[model samples]
Target: MPPVLDEFQGLSAFDAIMRHGNLGAGAEHLGISKSTLSRRISHLEYQLGQPLLHRQANRLIPTEAGTLFHQYCQQMLSLGERSQMALDELREEVSGDLSISVHPHFLRGWFNRLLTEFIEEYPGIRLTLTSNLQPPTREDDQVMLWLWEGPTRDSGLRDEVLGHQRQHLYAHPDYLRQHGHPQHPGELASHDWVNLIDRHHPDLVLHHPEQGEYRVSLPPSRFTVDNVVVHADHITHGAGIGLLPDHHVRTRSVAHPGQFEACLPEWQGPSIPVSLHYPFGHPPRKLGALLDRIRRHVPKDWGQP
Candidate 1:
């Protein structure tokens, strides 16, 4: 005799009966008459060489063996569903709606270029992008591009560091000419400053290769902007000296010509980490393809000096 597990229909009947607690409802769920459902369960019991269920007044109660068998049936059904889903993913085309949340600065710069390339690569995938200062919630089915400044705690999400951006002190040429260039990091305190309200600190810190670290007390800013692009714009228009990511300054240089100049060539500012975060499991095929495309197009030294 073959194993009772080979008869999938028998397993379904038993599971439905157990779930509904009555043969009539089970038969309705399976779209079969109660008589036929009864025969399937009877056949299943015969194959196992035991009476699986005891018929009560209004319901079918599982025996000890029946309860154990029901557990196996549930596991089998779950495995089958997962196997079918895996097969479907393999056979299906990579096409779906991919929602992403990204920092506004990236949307304005290198990330936009990567997005164009990604769309060209996968014409079937529709992309929706939102710019936000904070990461998206789990309820939102969206991937996020995040800038991690310090050590990130383990959040059980999938986080892949794409690259790093080096922060540098920059001032517009007009501002530099008017205020005169600071020869050393220590002299930066006297300059008018444009600062990012969220990112900048009250005390400016700089690192020198030979001289080590220098901390300068910052005065009131000439202008403060919350958005990175706007912050860069303020610095480009000679609002004040601002510490900005190198990539942002490079992107801004295209339009502003030679309006921007690095203030302290020898001092290195902090490095900002760029990362991609998504749910911590097997991503859908379309999202996987987009992630691959981004990995290919985005500069390896994204936030480097």
Candidate 2:
């Protein structure tokens, strides 16, 4: 069989069977009867020489091969729907499946809200948001959002700097009210300190890319959490004073003299790069639309809270 037609046949039949559990329902969906559906399945089995479905009581259950085939069929169908919807989006009428891979930290505020609004306005655009631990593998990733300090030399990735974020220390006014604000980074030890652990390393190793130094056995954790957002939340609730990015602490703190003051602001890096990476040239329709929407919506220095 030719590749495209063969792939389509496998996907469609797999889709039909998954959608309708029994052979009768699947046949009805395809405008064929149960017996014809059975014959087709039998022929498919003969060609592949394996049983796709298990013999059961009045219903068909997918075997292991059938399960894998169903997942592939689902992905293929999503691609088709995404293509149709993407073309519509280009007409200034948005539609498609906006498949994205974002880090856990980036899914805050406008990023979260943009997803909500994007789906609502362009109801045809289905979303499959996946968590990205590192850089994207596929060129079809459309837009990828990541935060890091300084240039990405030798990263072998093409991207544009969207914004620069500054990390600083923050404490609730209530916490500061009870515990006097530290005067120096050295004084960071005196309080009930909380820390965000880089889960990739949990032995309390720290890296200050700005200073080109490592502070091992740091992040004294009366409380230490893996996720930045959770650590930020604990700080917000006065769990303990900890370091956080300036933009992320905005939900609760007013930019003022006494509240959430940075103890050693000078010690922080010269703004970390918050960037968007995508394949060169015009992005796919859904991704292009999403990328534009993100730049328009996101704040200048939001991150790592």
Candidate 3:
């Protein structure tokens, strides 16, 4: 074995003893039995061919050689820590590739804007974006963004809530004008529904502040798509009433005035909880910086549906 590797434990034990000024405290600090620490120190002394410490009463006092050895050990430890810090700083400065898996619907609206800003802020980071309906199988250092209904229960990975997105029912003005607006959730069944099949069930559930919860069985629809963007497009063109995240509807309304209108404005759909997931450990400095940026940019409230 390499000399440093062979002596590392002994050196560490000696440093801990010196730092704590006694064998008992040092053993506790190193999470080792006092006998184990004493054996290590003895082995170290045997290797050096000299006693490095003198046991005086309840304390361990370094002999002349021990004092010299302690100084050298301090220098060695300091140099090691400084080298690590320098390498970490260099890693942060150097260019690196970051892969992120996200839902396609998130590629637009405020998320897209935030992503663009992230890219601009960190030109050294080359970002790879993958769009999938399901959370990608996370690699060693890759980050995954999940659009879920509630808190994630996986214990193997670290999950952080980015924000909550409210889903609301919306339709084109033309469709509502022709079909006539439904004043209540119960009347929704009689209308033509453009549904995002991925997010909706056969039965639609709506929540009211005072009326509580109501479930409406959706009729067989001529239009149903899995993608939220496509679903929004179908709603914009007056296909049928569909559920969309509040941000999408709000952004669409701003870009195209009088194009779409909310259906049953009094009721709200379930809020989709957005979370960012990564391997359960300290990430590389570059990836950590990117994660911090994401957390800072995410809006606290993505508007109410």
Candidate 4:
């Protein structure tokens, strides 16, 4: 007699029991009752005409045959996973659940348009996009997009540099008209500043092609905001002069002309690299398609490499 497809479940149960060295732990891990787990293993033993596991001081120790069989079980399980992956790849259309976590800033301006287009293109795909500040930790999350400050040290994740987010001081035309527009970086000190709540004293390091670096200590912000969109809203609504991403400013300018413009056109802000991280393997078609879509349609002004 040959083992049928259903026997793989028993093989998995046996493997879990062997790996955990107890029925209780294995059952808990598999989300099954101990009795149900015992039945599966007992049935597996019955098929083999021998006892696979013996009780030795609360531990489920595998017999010699069981020990040899466990190794084959591991190989079988690995093959099963590969078979499923192969089937997914061979599908006629890219379709499946794709989950992505991105920084909150990425969700602002123009990103929605890209998302709308992606949904239209891949109607079969079930997509979940989350705005997250923390790094990706969940194994089930297929992709993550975040601001990369420095080199990545996590060996478990595979990452690709998407672009650099360059920021510069911006202010509303109304505010500039009322407060008097600053002609120099030194003149910027007197203006009210809107900043992130996390920053105790946000320093502006402006770089010029000709004038060089000018580090300015920002005055304590009168308006502190936690959200990036709110920060931009305040700046656009005459709250104060604030640093904003170049791409975001451009998008806002196009959407609401003369609402916001750069304080100093020549000087540029620090470029924070945006990276895409995924589990260390060949990404599924859905994830791959989305990545390709982003690369293809990302705004040229976004400063992607």
Each candidate's clash count: 3, 1, 0, 0
Instruction: Arrange candidates by lDDT, descending.
Output: 1, 4, 3, 2
Write the residue-wise lDDT of candidate 1 on 1-305 in tens digits. 12333457888899999999999999999899999999999998999999899989999999999999899999997776666667667777877777777766666667777778778877887878877666544555445333333334555567788777777899888999899999987777788888887666788778888999888788788677778888877787788888888777777677767978998978878777777777776677777777887677666546532
What is the C-alpha lDDT profile of model 2 across 1-305, one tens digit per residue? 23334445545665788788887788778776777677777777777778789868888899999887677768877776666555555566456655666666666654677789878877778887766556544444453433333345444455667676666667766887788876655566567667766531223222354654333333457777766778877776776666676776665355333445554555552355666655554465666677778778767555532
Model 3, TM vs. native: 0.70
Q: How does candidate 2 score on lDDT?
A: 0.63
Select the stronger candidate by lDDT from 2 and 3: 3
Candidate 4 lDDT, tens digit per residue, 1-305? 12333447788899899889998999998889999999999888888898888999999999999998899989998777676666657664777777667667767556667777888888898777777666544354445433332234563676677777788888998898899888888887899899966532577788999999998888888888767788999998898898877877777777688888778888887776767677666666777787788778756765755
Writing each residue's lDDT as its tens digit, candidate 3 over 196-260 gives 76566688789999999999898778888877778888888888888888877777778778877
Return the clash pairs for model 2, or none. 96-125
Task: In candidate 4, list every pair of residues with a backbone clash.
Answer: none
* Candidate 3 lDDT score relative to the true structure: 0.76
Best model per TM-score: 3
> How do the predictions measure up, each by TM-score?
0.69, 0.54, 0.70, 0.66
| Cα-based lDDT for every prediction | 0.77, 0.63, 0.76, 0.76
Best-to-worst ranking by TM-score: 3, 1, 4, 2
> Where does candidate 2 have its weakest 10-residue lDDT segment?
198-207
Q: Return the number of clashes found in candidate 3.
A: 0
Clashing residue pairs for model 1: 164-303, 165-303, 166-303
Every candidate's CA RMSD: 5.6, 13.6, 9.0, 8.9
- Candidate 1 ranges beyond 4 A from true positions: 1-87, 142-156, 254-256, 303-305
